[model samples]
Target: MRTLALRGGARVAVVEAEWTDAFGVVTRGRVQLELRDGEPGPVLERDAGFWLRGTGVRALRNPGRRTARVRIVTPRTRTVTCPLPNTWRNEMSSMNDSGVVARTSHTSRLRGLAGIGFIAALAAMVATTLAAALARAVGVDFEIPDGGETIPLPGFAVVTGFFSVVGIVIAAALLRWSARPAERFVWTAVSLTAISLVPPLLSGAATATITALLGLHLVPAAVMIPTLARSLRTRTD
Candidate 1:
C-alpha cells in the first residue's frame, strides 16, 4: 500500500491499466470523482473506500482547501512504490489515449460565496427597512385593521433581517446539494416570494397599507434572489 498526497485543487488522471485491481481509501480531506464523460461523480470524505475497476471514473481531485491523501492498495503482484510526482505524470501520460481529465472546485470558493451571501442578506435587510420608512413617510400607516395596531419601524427591520438570513440558508443548502444550484435557488426563492404576497392581501388592511406591505415583501426578494443566484453561479467554480 502507498499513499498519494494531493494539494488542494489538484487532479490526478486515472489510467485503467495502472489502477487495475487497485482499491483506494480516502485517508484525509475529501476526494471528488470525475467521470469519463466529464460529469461529476460522488464526493468521498475521509475513510471512504472505493474501487475503480469497471467503473467509469476518469480522475480523482482534491476538493478542499487543505491537502488530501488517499491510501491505495494494489494486488500483491502489481504493488509498486515510486515518487508521487513522477507517478502522477506517468499515469497521466498513460491515459492520454482515453482523454481523461480532472474537474473540481476548491473549498475556498465556497467559503467566499458564503461571505458574499451574508453581506447580501444584510444589504437586503437595510434596503427593505429603508423602503418601509419611505412608505411610512408617504402616508402608509402600516396599520392592521384586524387589531388596529400599526407596524413599527423596528419590526420591519427585524423581520426583514430574519427572513433575509433564511433566504441565505436556503441558498447555501442548494449550493451544497443541488446539481443546478443557481437555477434551483431562483425557482425556490421566486416561489416563496409569491407566497409571501398572499399574507399581505389577506391582512384586511387599507389598500395603501396592503400595497406597501406587498412592496416590502418584493423589496427583499428582489435584493436576495438575484444576488444569491449570481453568487451561486460564481462559487460553483
Candidate 2:
C-alpha cells in the first residue's frame, strides 16, 4: 500500500509497472480520469474507489485548486511511490514552501470577488433608485396599506444596497465552501428572488404599487446574480 499526492492541476501518467493489479481509492479531494484518447473521464470524489487495469485510462488529474490524495493497494508486500519528473518535483516544492503561492492565489481570488460584488451592489442601488423614481412618475404610488405610509425614493436605494450586500455575503460564503459555487449561487439566488416576490403580492397595496414593487425587487436581482455568478466562475475556472 502507498499514497500518491497530486497538487492542483497536476497530472500523473499511468505506467504498468505501478498500476498493474492496483486498486486506487480517493482519500481526499477529487481525481479525474483521463481517457486513452486524451478526453476527460469521470471525476472520482473523496472515498470513491477505482481500478485502472484493463481500463482505457491514460492518466489521473487533480481538477480542483487543492491538493488531492489517493491510496493505492497492491498485492506486493513492498510500498511503491509515484515517481514525478524533476521539473514537476521542483514546482511542487515551490508550491509547498510555506504554502505562500496557494494562499496568495486564494486570497487574491476572494479579494477580486469582493471588489466586483461591491461595484455591482453600488450599481444595483443606483439602478433601483432610478427605476423607483420612474415608476413614481408613472403614477405608481409607493404606499403600503399595512403601514399607511409612503415609501420614500431614498428607501429604495437603501434597501437595494442592503440586500445587495447580503447577496454578496452569501456568494462569498458559497465560494469558500461549495464545490460548484457558481451553479449553487445561481440556484440559491434565483430561489430567494422568487421568494421575495411573495411579500409584494401580499403587501395589500394598490395594483400599480404591487406591480412596481415586484419590478423593483427584480431589478437588483438582475444586477447582482449574474455579476457575482460570473465573478465566481472566473475565479473557480
Candidate 3:
C-alpha cells in the first residue's frame, strides 16, 4: 500500500494495465474525477472519496486551488484503514478496505447507498421540525393538520421515517439494476416531490399554508438526491 497526495492543481495520468488502483479521500479541497472520454465522474468534497481503476479513466485532476490528497495501492488485495480527513472513518470504510474483490459501479451501487441516503433523510426530518418551530416563533402560524385536529409530532416523525426509507429503497433498487443511478434518482425524486405537492395543494389551506407545505415537500428531496449522488461516487478506498 502506498499513499499519494495531489497538491492543488496537480494532475495524474492513468496507466494501462489489467487493473490498477488509486484510492483517494479528499484531505483538504475538492478533486474532480474525469474519464478519458471526457465525462464528469464525481466531485470529491472534503472527506468524500473516489477511485481510479484500470485505464478506463484518463487522469485524476485537482479541480480546486487547494491541495487534494489521495492514496494508491499497488496490489488491490491489501487492507486499508486510514479515513478521509474529516468524514466518518469507520462508516466510510469500504469492502476494498477489507482486501476483497468488489463489484464495479456498473454492476451495483446500492450496497452502501441506502445507509447514506437514510442518514441524509434523518437529517432532513430534524431540519423540518426546526423549520416549523422557527416559522411559528416568527408568528407564521401556517399549520394545517390534514390527518387530525392536533399537530402530530410522532406522526410527523413516522411519516418522515417512512418517506426516507422509500428514498433508500429506490436508491438501492436503481443502483443494483440501473447504470445511471444518480441521474435516475434525481428525476425520480423530483417527480415524486412534484406529485406529493398535489395533495397539500388541494387541501384548501391558505396561500401561505400552501407555500409552507411546498417548502416541506422539497425538504426530503434536498437531502435524498445529494445523498444518493454522493453514494454513486466510485471509490476504491
Candidate 4:
C-alpha cells in the first residue's frame, strides 16, 4: 500500500515499471487523466477507483487549487512509500502546519482571479461606451424597436459591465472544476458571443443600428474573453 500526493496543478507521469498492476483510489480532491496523445481524459472525483494498467493514461493531474491524494494498493505484501521532491515536501509541510492553508490558498487564487475580472469588466465598460458614442457620432441611431426608445450611452456601459461580470463568473466556475479551463472558457465565450448577434439581427432595427449593435456586442466579448482566458491559464497552468 502507498499514497500518491499531488499538489494543486501538479502533474506526475505514470511509470509503467512502478504502476504495473497497481490500483488507485482517489482519496481527496479531483484528478484528471491525461491521455497518451496529450489530450485530457475524464476527471475522477473523491472516492473514485481506477486502474491505469493498459489504460494508456499518460499522467495524473490535480485540477483543483488544493492537494489531492490517491491510495494505491498492490498485490505484493511489502509496503512502499513514494517520497515527494524537496519543493513538494516543503509545500506539504506548510500545509500540514495548518488545516486552513489549503482553504486560504484556494481563496487567494480566487481573489486574484476576481481582481483580473474586475479590471477587465471596467475596461469592457469603457470600451463599449466609447464605441457606442463613436457609432452615434457617425449617424448610427441607437434605437431598438422592441423598447421604442433610444439606447443611451450609459446603458451601453451598464450592459457591458453586467455581461463582463457574467463572463468572469463563468471563468471562475471553470477554474474550480475544469482541467482545460482556458480553452473551455474561450470556446464557451465565443459561442455565446455568436449567439448574442442573433438578437440584433432580428430586432427589426435599421441596418446601421443592427450593425453597430453587433459590433458593440463583439467589443466587450473581445475584451473579456481573452483577459479571463489568459488569467485562467496562468492560474491553472
Per-residue error for 235 in candidate 2, Å, reads: 0.3
Candidate 1 clashing pairs?
none
Model 3 residue runs over 4 Å out of place are 1-109, 142-148, 235-237
lDDT of 1 by residue, 8-97 (tens): 778999898877766576767778888889887776666555667667788988766578898887767354564235544455445433
Per TM-score, the best of the predicted structures is 4
- TM match of model 1 to true structure: 0.63
Clashing pairs in 2: none
Better model by lDDT: candidate 3 vs candidate 4: 4
TM-scores, in order shown? 0.63, 0.62, 0.51, 0.64
lDDT of 4 by residue, 82-155 (tens): 53345433443454211211112345668999999999999999999999999999999878888699998999
- For residue 35, what is the lDDT in candidate 4? 87
Q: Estimate candidate 3's alpha-carbon lDDT, on a 0 to 1 scale.
A: 0.60
Instruction: Mark the 10 consecutive residues where model 3 has the least summed lDDT.
Output: 98-107
Of the pair 2 and 3, which is ahead by TM-score? 2
Residue 84 displacement (Å), model 4: 9.7
The CA lDDT of each predicted structure is 0.77, 0.80, 0.60, 0.80
Candidate 3 vs. truth: CA RMSD? 10.1
Backbone collisions counted per model: 0, 0, 0, 0
Between 1 and 3, whose TM-score is larger?
1
lDDT of prediction 4: 0.80
